[model samples]
Each structure stands twice: as structure tokens, then as C-alpha cells.
Target: MVSVVGFLFATQARMPDHLRFAFRILTLVFDAWPYATTGKPFHRLDLPRRIDQVERWKRSRLAFRQGLIAFYRSFVIFGLYSELSKQDADRGMRAKQD
Candidate 1:
């Protein structure tokens, strides 16, 4: 399902360095807690509860990988866009000078 994939994606870099998640703190929360609430004590989650955690771990990992790929690709695209803009501005400046 979509959520499963999403969960795996989130788990990828949910730990150290926090690759590129929604937010730093959000990723930190994921890293700090990869399990579910057991409805018991504040910090109590049964072993089975960890199943969701495992799925999330997998989700995060996949998402992180995809994010890295997307990020690198975007840099290329953005770089091209930036270069074009810069060239356009330079052209205008040159025109004014002429």
C-alpha cells in the first residue's frame, strides 16, 4: 500500500544525519522511536508493536534512497535553470551597457 511504501521511505534516513525528511525534528522522532505505542506506560511498546516500526524502518529507508536520487537529479535541473537565468540577466545588462 501507499503507506507501507511511505513508511519504508521514512525509515531510511530516520537515524543519523537525517538525509532529507519532512523536517529535522520529525526525522529525529522517527529515529528515536521506531516502534508503536503499546497504550501502557509512557515508554511502553510491546514486541509485536514493533512490527509497524519494522515496516516504517523499511519505508524510511526506501524513501531516503528515492529522496537522494531525486535530490541529485533536481540539482542538475535547478542548476540548468539557474544558469539560464544568470545568462538572461547578463544579456540584459550587456544590452543596457551597449
Candidate 2:
């Protein structure tokens, strides 16, 4: 998640201030919304609960809500694959060194 955020902000550095501000607000709402039902922040939730929350957002009736999750999901998936490939390259380099 941290990596995703880092990648998002780093890649979005040139985005308009208003759009970036909106993204930050939406992120806070995403993390804070779960607190109403679970009495815990989104980050503090267990894996199952976290998945459930994301699923809820993905299935939300609001178009913006659904879009928010979609945006986040894309970054997350991309970040995961990128990290995996990086690790693979590092491992291959180490193997060659040995």
C-alpha cells in the first residue's frame, strides 16, 4: 500500500493541484469510512475486513466511489507486478555474482 501510494504520488507529481487535492481527500475518506462500522481505521483492519471494505467500495452505487476503487486497484496491481519483477531481476543479478 505504501509502495502504491509512493508510485501514485510520484507519477502524479505533474497533475493539477485540484485533482491531486481531490485524490488526497478521497483517500482520507476511504480510510476513515470504515471506522463507522468497525471502530478501527482502514489500515488497522485485518486482511479480511480490508478486502471487504474494498469490495464494498468497488460495488458502491456511486460512480465516483467505484471509480476511486478502480483507480486504486490499478495502481496496486501494477505496483505488485513491478515489485515482483524488480525482485526477480535482483535475484538474477545475485545468482550471476555467485
Candidate 3:
């Protein structure tokens, strides 16, 4: 999750000015959502704190909150699996060299 944020920033250098500005604003909202509900700054708290909140939010009757949880979960899960795939590929290549 943190790596995704960093990768976005590193690529931002090549993005258009307007897109970069929009990305910054979107990042602020994503990072601030937890603090808005939980009162703890995102950097100071463990991610499980936010994960628990999102799990509760997923059970909410409101459509928007549930949708948000679904969307966020998809993104996080995809990133995690992608990282795992990369790690497996690297391990395979290293084994071939030995």
C-alpha cells in the first residue's frame, strides 16, 4: 500500500501538470478519510486500525460507504497480488542463476 503511493509519486514526475495536481488532491482525500473518522493521524496508527474501521464500514447500510470499501479493497488486493507475483518471478530468476 505504501509502495503504491510511492510508485505513484515517482511516476508523477513524468505526468502532465494537471494530472499531477489531481493525483495530489485524490491522495489527500484517501489519506485523510481515516483521520476524519478515527481522530488518529494515518502515519501514527497501524494499518489494522483502519482495516478494522473499513470492515465495519463495509457492513453499513449506506450504499456509498459500502461501495467505497469495495473499491478500496479491490485496489489493495490487486496491488498485493501483483507484488507477490513480482517476488515469485525474482526468486525464480535467482534460482536459475545458481
Candidate 4:
């Protein structure tokens, strides 16, 4: 989540102020959405509930909601793979040195 937010901000650095603000507001909404069902913010939810909430968003009928989740999902996956790749590269370098 932190990586996703950082990636978002970094990518949006040159975007118009209004769009940047809208993204920030949307991030808050995403964090708050789980509260309706579990009375807890998204980040504070347990793993199972967090997965459930994301599934709900992915299956939402509203196109905007679907798109929003898709956008975040892409970033999350990218961040995960990026970190993994970085670790792998670091390990390879260490092995070469040894």
C-alpha cells in the first residue's frame, strides 16, 4: 500500500493540481470504503477482510468503481514484482561477489 501510494504520487507529480487532488481524495475514499461493512478502515482490516473488500471492488457494477480498482491493482502488482526483481538482482550481485 505504501508502495502503491508512492508510485501514484511519483507518477502524478507533473499532473494538473486538480487531478492530483482528485487522486488524493480517491485514495482516502478507498481507505475508508471497508468501514461500511467491517467498521474498520481498509488498511486496518485483517488480510481476509482486505481481500474480500478488494474482491467486492473488482466485481462492482459501476464502471468507475471497477476502473478505480483496476488502476490500483495494476500499481500494486507492479510494485510487488518490482521489489521482487530488485531483491533478485541484489542477490545475484552478492553471489557474483562471493
TM-score of each: 0.34, 0.77, 0.58, 0.74
lDDT (Cα, 0-100) at 2 in candidate 4 = 46
Ranking by TM-score: 2, 4, 3, 1
- Candidate 1 lDDT, tens digit per residue, 1-98? 22433444444446455434344544455445634444343135566754555455555656753454454345555565666787899999999999
The deviation in Å at residue 68 for candidate 2 is: 1.2
RMSD of 3: 4.9
Tell me how candidate 4 scores on lDDT.
0.81
Global CA lDDT of candidate 3, please? Answer: 0.67
Q: Which candidate should be chosen as best, given lDDT against the real structure? A: 2
Residue range 29-91, candidate 3, lDDT tens digits: 555777867786655568888677667678989775676567556666666677888889999
Name the 10 consecutive residues with the lowest summed lDDT in model 1: 34-43
- lDDT, candidate 4, 1-98, per-residue tens: 34756876576675689867877787789899988878999999999988887898889998766877887788778877888888899999999999
Highest TM-score: which candidate? 2
Per-residue accuracy of model 2 over 1-98 as CA lDDT, tens digit each? 34766887675675688877887788899999989888999999999999999999999999878988988788778987898888899999999999
Q: Mark the regions of model 3 whose C-alpha exceeds 4 Å error after superposition.
A: 6-48
Residue 23 alpha-carbon offset, candidate 4, angstroms: 2.7
- Best-to-worst order by lDDT is 2, 4, 3, 1
Specify the poorest-scoring 10-residue window by lDDT in model 3.
Answer: 1-10
Please give me the total number of clashing residue pairs in predicted model 3: 0
Winner of 2 and 4 under lDDT: 2
